[model samples]
Target: MSTLPRSLLKNLDLFRSVSEHDLDTVLQIAQTMRLQAGEPVFQQGQVAENFYILLHGHLKVVQTTPEGEQITVRYVMPGEVFGIARAMRRPTYPAACIAVEESIVLSWPSSEWDHVIARNPQFAFNALQTVGQRLQDAHTRIKELSTEEVEQRVARCILRLVDASGEQTEEGVSINFPITRQEIAEMTGTTLHTVSRLLSSWKEQGLVNTGRKRVTVRRLDDLIRLAEGQPPGGTAASKRNSVEPL
Candidate 1:
């Protein structure tokens, strides 16, 4: 835990302003778990006995409706703290967290949730900040789904991914994580066919390049124009009354 503490806590927002000594103590109680791709870290409605921090790889937070449809709430990158049901005042997990690839996470028992918070003032503030940001992002996604066209929604979804984990490439910015059109559709409240068609058109227009589990933005400005509800060559107002495809 001594060696792991400095490197893991250095860049994490949850550990903002935390002392190296305090972080070391917290890491001592954490248990590490490694998951394979498609494996679930926790299921919705499961007893929330622990909270977790993603140490490596990616995860998708998903919720299933009574109709058996799954909605992708968001993607979790490394350094994210999740499954904090105690923070939400819930006794069970609100959604399922599944690994997008091979991953590692450090988890602590829920019993320590209060002690951890009390031990570090900055941790509480950082935790609340993370939760607040998630709330804001949810609002923005809802607004986009309610008001934007399919193409606009798709574009915004990709842009969000690009902002989160994109890496510079010779061609343009590439989403560093593996993602598929189906997952994009789930995130944007659309269908796979619609997502595929939009990506295909964008590829043909030289705005993006897409392949199996990969997407690279070739012309970011043009993509932003589309996301803003203005085509690359024309201006258009956002369709406020439009409903996203099911």
Candidate 2:
């Protein structure tokens, strides 16, 4: 058994729906682990013996292509669960998980997972919902990559990140954490030069403001226009209404 702070324990999804007694029982089997930025929590094909909930900072899920190029699959933020291979009954991890920032995580051994799920059907239902959402997001990204231009794909990627983890400021909505042009390129399957050029163009048009490692949307309308591949005007406004707000 490992000791964990009460505050962190309270926020984890697996514990949230359970009764107080169950929550305490679950915590008795949990361990807290700390990871440094750029540290590998687990490698591809590693044994899936434990599941984790991110308590702080960010994690990147990545896979390498046959050609040896690394591609980012998704960014996992605090309060999100990762290492679900055990729960899903996979013997090994499908993708590698790395800390994008210094992070803290709560881990439960695979043995406890079966007991928890058997006792709490809600946990199983929630896990399925999370998987479904991820599948939808993957499908959307695949469609964008197949059909959209590099600029539009990049725009949509940024918009999704902002919606997931953005902080509102007087200037605009800032992505909650730092991101690099290289990471953006990897995510959108575009060249670094292309990302830089497109972002510069948006800046010139007053659509965004870029800092050293941050991006803020200044004119959301203009960004939306680029994302939809539409000329700036009435068509963009109509599209905006249909887009769910972040």
Per-model TM-score on C-alpha atoms? 0.90, 0.89
Q: Model 2 segments beyond 4 Å from truth?
A: 233-246
Native-vs-model 1 lDDT?
A: 0.85
Q: Relative to the unseen true structure, what is the C-alpha lDDT of residue 213 in candidate 1, on a scale of 0 to 100?
A: 97
lDDT for position 63 in model 1: 97
In candidate 1, which residue pairs get closer than 3 Å at backbone N, Cα or C atoms, i.e. clash? none
Compared with the true structure, what per-residue lDDT tens digits does model 1 show for residues 1-246? 534647667677777677877788898888889999999999999999999989899999999999999888899988888899977899999999999899998899999999899988877887787799999999999898888899998999998999999888776788888898989999999999999999999887777888879999877777888999886752233222111121
Which portions of model 1 show Cα errors greater than 4 Å? Answer: 1-5, 233-246
What's the lDDT for all of these models?
Answer: 0.85, 0.80
In model 1, state the lDDT of residue 43.
98
